[model samples]
Structures are given as structure tokens and as C-alpha cells.
Target: MQSGLTRDRLIAILMLLPSIILVAIFVYGFIAWTGYTSLTDSNALQQLSGLPAQFIGLKNYNDLFTGGLNLRFRIDMVNTVFFTVMFILVCLAVGMGLAILLDQKIKGEAIFRTIFLFPMALSFVVTGVVWKWLFNPTSGFNVLPTILGLPAGQFRWFISEERWWPFAWQDVPLILSILFLGIAIFAALWYWSKRRSQTAALLAALALLLLAWITFGNPRSLSGLNPERPEAHGFNVALIAIVIAAGWQMSGYTMAMYLAGLRGISEELREAARVDGCNELGVYRHVVFPLLAPITLSAMIILGHISLKIFDLVYTMGGGDNLYIDMPGINMFFTTFRSNQFGQGAAIAMLMLIMVAIVIVPYLASQLRSETKL
Candidate 1:
């Protein structure tokens, strides 16, 4: 009997071997090849024929960070940070709001849910095309305000070159002061919670003083690396339109996730909080929101990864020439296929992979450990 069982197990292993081998070769093998290509001076398209390539170590990465010729990469890096942060925050807030409303068991709940989720069914290409027409500066949706007897709107959506909240990159001292103030606020809260009111008050006072000095005492203008162009660029307002379109498409998915989380919470717990003198707002703020932490974290990770790798939507909507709305994915596509610069493109790809892994791997490890404990 033991020998028969051993033979059956061996047969099962043999049956699965092909699939395992295929995955290892196609998925991980290609990833290794890409990493290897990124370490070389492999710009020629003919290099795809397995010709000898020159290994240049980290020169490509260094060029991306500090090379004068790689200004587009640096600008795209800024755009990516702004786009991802705003996209994630807006999606989370909108999704949570919609989920909370739907959880109230309102009338026509199914109809409302369908209406909200319908956008998610459409592809990013479709979403981008529709938004592009809607945001056309001189035409499309811009004419609505004039039709309504309002002043003709001059907003240029994605084509606008203007930036807001402009500040020089050399203003690191001012930025640090603001960040210190934020830290002081959190420290004050911690101290107050520990019944150290005096210490909390002192911290708050110092933070205010530091903020005032940074704002009023400093008279010199902050500058960038190029001293000739002292005025630094700020957030591109053009991205607001893109964020709106993307958020409209993805908020429904987040709403569905948050709704599921809300439904999983026991009703009795909410009722108990209410009975304990918590109002509707208090219950949501204190009890319900805390319960939804896991859902929020999951949504953030999913949306963050999507934002980091976003390509089709921005490409279709903003086009390739708009530097204000450029992203790494678009840059990578142009660099590899359009410009025939495979080495730089592969470097960008590796950096994107590292960024995504940084955000997701830790969360996944923690989840696995929790499952193990359970």
C-alpha cells in the first residue's frame, strides 16, 4: 500500500512539472533577462538579436538622477509623485463617502450602486477619450459656462502650462520647518493623551514660533539648481482634470470594497456605540472608521500600484507631448520603442518594479504572518 501511494504522488508531481517549468521560464526568466539588459549600454534595436552587449553597471541610473540630458526623467518623476499621491487620496475619500451613503440602506440602492460602478466597466482608453473631449479648452464642455450666462471659462485642461503654489526647490529649509510643525502637532497629541498637557502646550507654542520665523523672517527667494532660473515650477494644475477622470473611473471599485468592509461589521457594535452616547458622526469617526482600517490599507495599495504604472489613460488623454502630465510609463514606452533607447527604458522599468515592490511586499508579508498565526 505504501509503495502504491508513493507511485501515485510521483505521477501527480510529473503531471504538474510542465506547468511549473513554463512559469519559471516565461515569467521569472524574462524578468531576470530584463534586469541584465538594464545593466548594459544596450541602446541598439539590433541588440534584440542576442548580439554582444557592453556592461556599464549603474551609469544609466546615475544619468537618470543627475545627468543634464535626462531632464525629462526628473520632471516625469515629479509628475508621477504628484499624480499618484493626489489620485490615491481623492479615490479613497470619494469611495469612502459613497460607501457610507450606500450603507445607510437608502432607496434604489441597487440602481445607485450600478450607476456608480458603471464607469469601472469601461476601459481606460474609453475613459480617456471621453474626458479628452469633455475637457477641450476652447470647445466641448468649456462652452457650458457661456451657455449658462457665466463668463467664458478659459481653463485649458491638459494643455495648460500654468502651475500653482510655485516654490523654488532650494526652499528645503522652509519645507523642513513646515514638516517640523506637523511633527510637533502629532507629538503634542501624544503627550496630551498621556496626561502631559503642559508639555503638549509647549510643543505647540514652539511649532507656531518656528512656522512664523520661516514665513516672515526669511526674505531671500529660494532657487533651484540653475541659479539663472531662480523661480521654480510648482504643481501642474493640468493634472486636476486627469485626476478627476481617473477617480471617476476607479472610485466605484473602491466603493464596492469599502461597502463590503462596512457590511462585515456587526450591527450590534454600532448600536452599542450609539447607546453609549455616541452620535452618528461620532460613531463613524471613532468606531466605524477604525473598523475599516484594513479595507483602507488594501485599497491604498491597489490604487497606489495602479497609479504608479498608469499608462493608457494618460497617453490617450494628455498625449505624448504634454510634459506637464508626463508619467514614467509613457516615458518608458517612448524611450524603448520610439527612441530606441533600450538601456534607459529598462532602467525605468526596474525602478518602477522596485517602487511597486516597496509598497506591496511588506503588506503581503504581514498578511501572510497573520494567516499563519490564525
Candidate 2:
């Protein structure tokens, strides 16, 4: 019996070995190769000749953040920050609303769910194309005003270059450090309230380490390593159009998550809340939202990574060359493929990976911890 069990386990391991090997090589191996390339001064000839590129340790990343010729990358970073925040907030709000409405056992519930979820099935490229038409400066919605006997609307959509709350590039490190400090302090307080001193202490330590790194270490040189000028960076109004498009496509996914979370909550718990003198709004505020915290965290992490790595959607909507709303992904593509600046492109890719990992790794660790407890 023991030999039979051992043989079964051995066969299972053998069956999984091919997939593990493939993932290790194609996924992680390529990631390492990209990291190595990013540290080099590779160009088109080297790529074509299959020759190793010269290493220039951190130059590509430094140039991207604080160098003279990389203003576009700075703009992309600022835009990413605002876009990620807005996209996640919008998706959560819209998804929660839709989930709540549908949870009331509305008529044609399945049809409404299918309709809402249909966009998630479509590729972002398709969604972007559709939204681009809808957002065309002089054509789509602009003409609707004229049809309504009003003058044609003059909104520039993605072409608008107007910035809100612009700031000097030099202050980036201080700004980010402050933000990190705020979050860390908040988490420490929350954990302390829960009497989780070890977790709270760990968060405080990590936060301090990050603050030190941003200030003194400056790995990506966020302190303006070699700025041409401390160029103004801020929230681009043009991102509103893209945000709307993205929110439309991705909110359905959040809705599904929220809807599942809502259903998992017992009806009895809600009844108990009512018996305790909680109204509908109070029930949701005090009970439902709190219970859905895990879902919210998961959604934010997932959406945050997606927003950080967004490529096809931005490319399809604004065109990579659109200075007003160019994203890191689009810029990376243009740099690598269009201009054959492989090293710089790889640097952008690595930065993006780092950002996504910052958002995802904590959530993953929490999940693993929960599973171990279970």
C-alpha cells in the first residue's frame, strides 16, 4: 500500500515536471534575461547579431527617471499614478453599485449580469478602439450637442495637454516617501489596534526601509539624478477619456468579485443587523463593506497591477506617440520595436514589473498566510 502511494506521488510529480520546467524557462528565465538586458547598452545591431550587449549598470533606469532625454517617461509615471488611483476607485464604486442593484433580485437579472460582464470578455484592444471612436474630438459625442441644437462641444478628449496640480520632478522622492510614510503609519496603527504587534512592527520596519531607500538610496534615482530640467508633471486631463474606457471594460470583473462576496455574506447576518437597529444604509456601511474588505483589497491589487502594466489599451486608444497621454507600456513598445532602443525599453519593463510587484506581493503573502492558518 505504501509503495503504491509512493508510486502515485512520483507519477504526479513527473506529470507536473514538464509544466514546471517550461514556466521556469519561459517565464522566469526570460524575466532574468530582460533584467540583464536592461543593465546593458544594447541597440539594434546587437539584437540582430545575437551578441551580448555592454553592461552599463543602472544607467538605463537612471536615465529614464532623471536624465535629460527622458521627459516622456516621467510624464508616463505621473500619468500611471493618477490613472491607477482613478481606475481602481472608479471600478470599485461602479462595481459595488452594480452588484448592489443586481443583488436586489432585479428583473432579468441573468441578462443584466451577462450584459455587464460581456465587456470583460472583449480584448482591451477592442474596447479601446470602440472608446476611441466614441471619444473622437470633433466627431462622436461632439456632434451630439449640435444635434441637440447646441454648438458642437469642443472637448479635446485624449488630445488635451492640460495638466492639473503639476509639480517639479525634483521633489518626487520626497513626495513618494511621504506617501509611503502615511500608508505605513496607518497600517501600523490599524494593526496595533488589532493587537497584532509583530505584523505591525514588520510593516513599520518595511516602511522605514522604503523611506530610507527612496531618500538616500534612490535606486531608480527619483531624486533627480540628472534632470535636464525639473519638468512639470501632473494629472493629465486626457486620461479621463482612457479612464472611462478602462473603467467600462474592467468594472464588470470587480462587480463579479463584489457580487460573489455579497452573496457569501449570510442573510441572517443582515437580519441581525436590522434587529440591532441598523437601517439599509447602516447595514451596508457597518457590516457589508467591512466584511468585503478582503475582496476590496484583492480587487485593488489586481486592478493596480493591470493599470501599471496596461499596454494594448493605451496603444489602441491614444497611439503611442500621443505625448499628452502616453503610457510606460506604449512608450516601451515604441522605444524597443519602433526605435530599437532595447536596453531602455527593458529598463521601462523592469520598472513596471517592480511597481506591479509592490502592489501584488503583499497581497499574495497575506493569501499564503491565510491558507496556512486554514
Candidate 3:
């Protein structure tokens, strides 16, 4: 019996060896090769004529981040930040709202859930095509007002050059200061609500305030002596149409995740809260929502990564021409395939990988630790 078992295990290992080797070669090997390529000078298509790749460590990265070659990278980075933030937040809000509604045992729950989730069944290309028509400034959904006997709406969707709420990239210090102050205020409120020591809360708030003050005490200090005074382009309102389309497609996935989480929660716990004088809203706010923190984090990470690496939707809907809708993925494609800048494109890919790793690695580590504890 022992000999037979050993032979079976060996056979299993041999059967899996091909898959393991393929994965190592195709996945990890390619990743290593890409990293090496990013550090080389392989830009022009002529360089691909069997010539050896020349080593040029870190130049591509530097050029991408700060070089005066083009504003494409910087602008794409800003647009990516705005798109990811808005996409994740809106998806979470809409998903959670839908999940909560479904959890209440509403009428036609099955039909409603199906309707919400149906969008996820469609491909990104299809979603983009549908939205492209809907956003056509002249002939598509924009003409509905005229059809309804109202004046035609003149809002330009993806082709608009107008921007609002603009602020220079050099003003990041001031932005961070304002954000830190707001966080400090929230931290103080949270501590007070939790009945933590007033002294501790006050000290925390004071420290944050001091940091903010140091960062942005003077506009001149924050802006620096030779800051690049580039034209500010605030959050593109054109992205609103894109966001709505993406959110409509993704919110259903989030809702399904959240709905599963809500269902897994024991009804007894909810009833117990009610028995303890908690209203529906209070129960959700103080108990149910807090309990779904893990689900929320999971959904956020998933949606955030999707938004970061998004290509098809933007490519199909905006055709990568709108500066407001440009992302690293589309930019990398254009740089490498269209413009034949292989090194810079590889660098962009590596940067995007790093960004995704930053968001995902911690959550994965935490999950492993929890599983180990279990």
C-alpha cells in the first residue's frame, strides 16, 4: 500500500510538471524580461533588427516622470488618479446602496438583482460602444431634449476641451495640507465618539495641524522658487460620462459581492440590534455596515485595480484621443506599438505593475495572516 501511494504521488507530480514549467516561463520569465527591457534603449523599430539591446538604466523612468519630452505621462498620471478615485468611490456607493435595498426583502428582488447584474455579463467593448453613442454630442442621446420639444443640450461629452476647478500640479503641497487637516478633524471626531481620552485626541489633532501648517504655511514656500507653472487641468467633466458608463457596468458586481456579505450575516444579529432599540438606519450604520468592512475592502481593491489597468473601455469609448480619458494602459499602447518607443512603454507597464502591487500586496498579506491564524 505504501509503495502504491508513493507511485501515485510521483505520477501526480509528473503530470503537473508541464503546467508549472509553462507558468514559470510564460508568466514570471516574461515579467523578468520586461523589467530588463525597460532598462534598455530599444525605442526605434530599426533597433528590433536583431541588434543587441543597449543598457540605459533608469533613464526611461526619469524621462517619464520629469523629463521635458512631453506632458503626456504627467497628464495621464493625473487623469488616472481622478478616474480611479471616482470609479471606485461611485461603484462602492452604488453597489452598497443596491445591496442594502435588496437586503430589505423588497418586492421583485430577483428581477431587480438580475437587472442590476446583467451589465456585468456584457463585454467592455459592448459597454463602450453603447456609451459612445449615448454620449455623442450632436446626434445621439444629446438630441433627446430637442425630441422632447426642449432646446437641444449643448454639452460636449468626450470631445470637450473645457475644464473646471483647475489647479496646478505644483499646488500638490497645498492639496496635501488641506487633506491632512480634514483627516485630523475626522480622527478627532472618531476618537471622541469612541470615548477615547480627550487629551490623546487633542494631541493627535494638534500634531496633524502642525504638520499641515509646516507643509502649507506659505504659498510661496509650498510652490517653491522654480516650480513649473504648467496650465492647470482639473478633473475633466468629460470623464463624468465615462464614469457613469463604467460604474453602471461594475456596480452590479460590487452589489453581488455586498449582497452575499449581507446574506451571510445572521438575521439573529440584526434582530438583536432591533430588540436593543436600534432603528433600521442605525442598525445598518452601527452594525451591518461595519461588519461588511472586509467585503468593502475587497471590492475596493478589485475595482481600483480594474480602474488602474483599464484599456478597452476607454479605447473603445474615447478612442484614446481625449486627454481627459487617457490612462497609462492606452498611453503605453500608443508609445510602444504606435510610436515604437519600446523602452518607455515597458517602463510605463512596470510603473503600472508597481501601482497595482501597492494596492493589492498588503491586502493579500493580511488575508494570508488571518488564514494562518484561523
Candidate 4:
């Protein structure tokens, strides 16, 4: 019996060995090697062996933060956070909304679904190039609007530095969409109540007054359109473009996942809600959303990860220049690589890894907890 047990244990270990080897080689091994490189002052073309690539402690890290503006270290960190947060939020909201809309028994559902998923099928490189052309001032979207008889010189809209507010045009719609949705749910409810009950006419009047007041309180100008300063124009444009394109591309996949989650939900729960006097909105809010939480959390994590590592889209859309403008995570890598600063480039990669981990760990913990309870 003892001999037989030993044989079984040995066989199990042998079977697991290859996966462990691969993880050590590709995962932990690369991470340790990169961490070592980050501590040294290595260059791209030729790593100076004679100079001793030994442990320099956090010297490289210190230099990165306080050494020179060439590093643009602080700026890069700020940009990474800013871009990641905004992109994740926008993608989640838009994707979920698309999922809900497609969930309805709409006509030509397959065609519409395919159109949405088409961008995700291609690599980000392809999507970026297409968007760049569509957004280009000279022969792109600017030309179309002007040719369509909107006005003179509106075609150069993307590049305009004056009152043209190029970035505003790009970023505003998404921001406004996000902002509007929060208000719209209540607005929709208010409208429904007013229509159903004549006694609630006064409440509808109050809601309209509130909406108009809020609208006027905020600036009418699109945030992306403002080119008050030269330094802001290019990066802003690139960031907005990338976010919109990515959000649109990934939305279909999110929708499909959500639809699957929705399908897995038994009809009996919804029927119970209906029997309990829950309306359509109430059923979705109380029953459907709670059951779908696990899938939604998964989608959120994927969206966040994609935003953090986004490269090809920005690369193709803005070329290598986007990094230089103000994108720290991207710009740092490009600049370091260009300057033959291999150590610094590795450090930048490490920084991005840390930031992404910060986001993902907490998110995953919450997801696991929720799932365990369910």
C-alpha cells in the first residue's frame, strides 16, 4: 500500500512539473529578470557589462522620480491613472447599456451584434489606424462635415488650436453620455409617473425646472474642443480617440457575456418578482442585476486590464508620437527605448504593472467574496 501511494504521488508531481516549469520561465522568471534590469543602468544597443550591473538599490527608481524631466516620471504616473480610470468607467457604462439594448428582442439582432463585435475581432492596431483616418483633419472627418454643408473650415476640426475646440468634440460626447445617464434614469421615472398619474403633473414641472437649471449651470463647451493651450491639444485628442474606439470595440463582447449571464437566470425568479408587484424597472434592478453581478464584475476587470495595457490602438492612431505628448506609461516606454535606456524602459513597465495590480487585486477580492456568498 505504501509503495503504491508513493508511485501515485510521484506520477502526480511529474504531471504538474511542466506547467510549473513554464510559469517559472515565462512568468516569475521574466518578472525577476526585469526587476533586476530596473535596478541597473542598462542601455538598449549594448548593455555595458564592465560597468557592473549589480544591485544599485532603488537608485534607478529615485532617478526616475527626481532625476530629470526627460523621464517625465511624475507626469507619466498622473496620466496613467487619469486615462485608466476614465476609460474603464466609460467602457463599462457604454458596454452595459449596449448589452441591455441588445437584450431586448430587437430585429436584425445578429447583424447589429456582429457590427459591434467587428472591431474586437481585429487587433487594436487595425482599429487605431481606421480611427486616425476618420479623425484626421485634412482628409478625414473634418472634410466630411464641411462637404456636407455644415460650415466652412469645420473639416480641419481635429487639428484646430484656436476656438475650434478639437478635443472637446471628441471627449465631450462620452463624458456627457456618462453624465446624462445618471440623470436620465430619474428623468425617465419621473416622466413615466407623470404620464401615468395626472396628480404628479406638478412633480414633472419641478423635474423639468431642475434639468434646465442644471444644464445651464454647466458650461456648454465640449471639454475636448478646448485648445486653450498648445501643449494640451495632441495628447488630449489621442486619449479621447483611443477611449472612444476601444469602448465601442469591446462593448460587443461585454454585451455577449451579459446576455449569457442573463440567460442563465431562471425565469422563475423574474416571475416571482412580477408576482410580488415589481414593475419592469424594479424587476431588473432588484432581481436581474443582483444575479448578474458575478459576470458584470468579470467584465469590469477585463475592461480595466485592457485600458491599462492599451498600446496598439494608441500606437496606430497617434503613431509613436502620442507617448511623447503626455502619456506617461506609453511615452516613457517609447522614449526610453528610443534613447537606448533599457533599464528605464523596464522600470516604466514595472510601474504600469504595479498600478494595474493595485486596481485588479481589490476588484478581484470583491468579486470572489461576492461569488462565495452567492
Residue-pair clashes per candidate = 0, 0, 0, 7
> Which one wins on lDDT?
2
lDDT of 4 by residue, 1-374 (tens): 36555877989989999999999999999988888888877775555455555566677676665453443655444445556766777766776777778778689988988887787798887777787787776666556656677753443322322322333323433445546655655665776766855434544565565566455644333332333532222233345555667776787788788878877778899999999999989999999999888787788788777777777666666545544324555665575767878777778778778877976999878868979999
TM-scores, all models, native as reference: 0.82, 0.90, 0.86, 0.70
Say which prediction, candidate 1 or candidate 2, comes out ahead on lDDT. Answer: 2
Cα misplacement distance, residue 230 of candidate 2 (Å): 2.6
The runs of at least 3 residues in candidate 3 whose Cα sits more than 4 Å from the true structure, single-residue gaps closed, are: 1-15, 46-50, 173-228
lDDT against the true structure, per candidate, is: 0.86, 0.90, 0.85, 0.66
Give the per-residue lDDT digits (tens) of candidate 1, residues 309-350.
999999999757998888889988999989888888999899
What lDDT score goes with residue 352 in model 1? 88
lDDT of 3 by residue, 179-258 (tens): 77677777877787788868557858686776757565764344432365554658877888778889999999999999
Candidate number with greatest TM-score = 2
Clash number for candidate 2: 0
- Candidate 1 is scored at a TM of 0.82
Q: After superposing candidate 1, which stretches have Cα over 4 Å from the reference?
A: 1-16, 45-51, 167-233
| Sort order, TM-score high to low | 2, 3, 1, 4
Off by over 4 Å in 4: 1-9, 44-49, 152-237, 323-329, 362-374
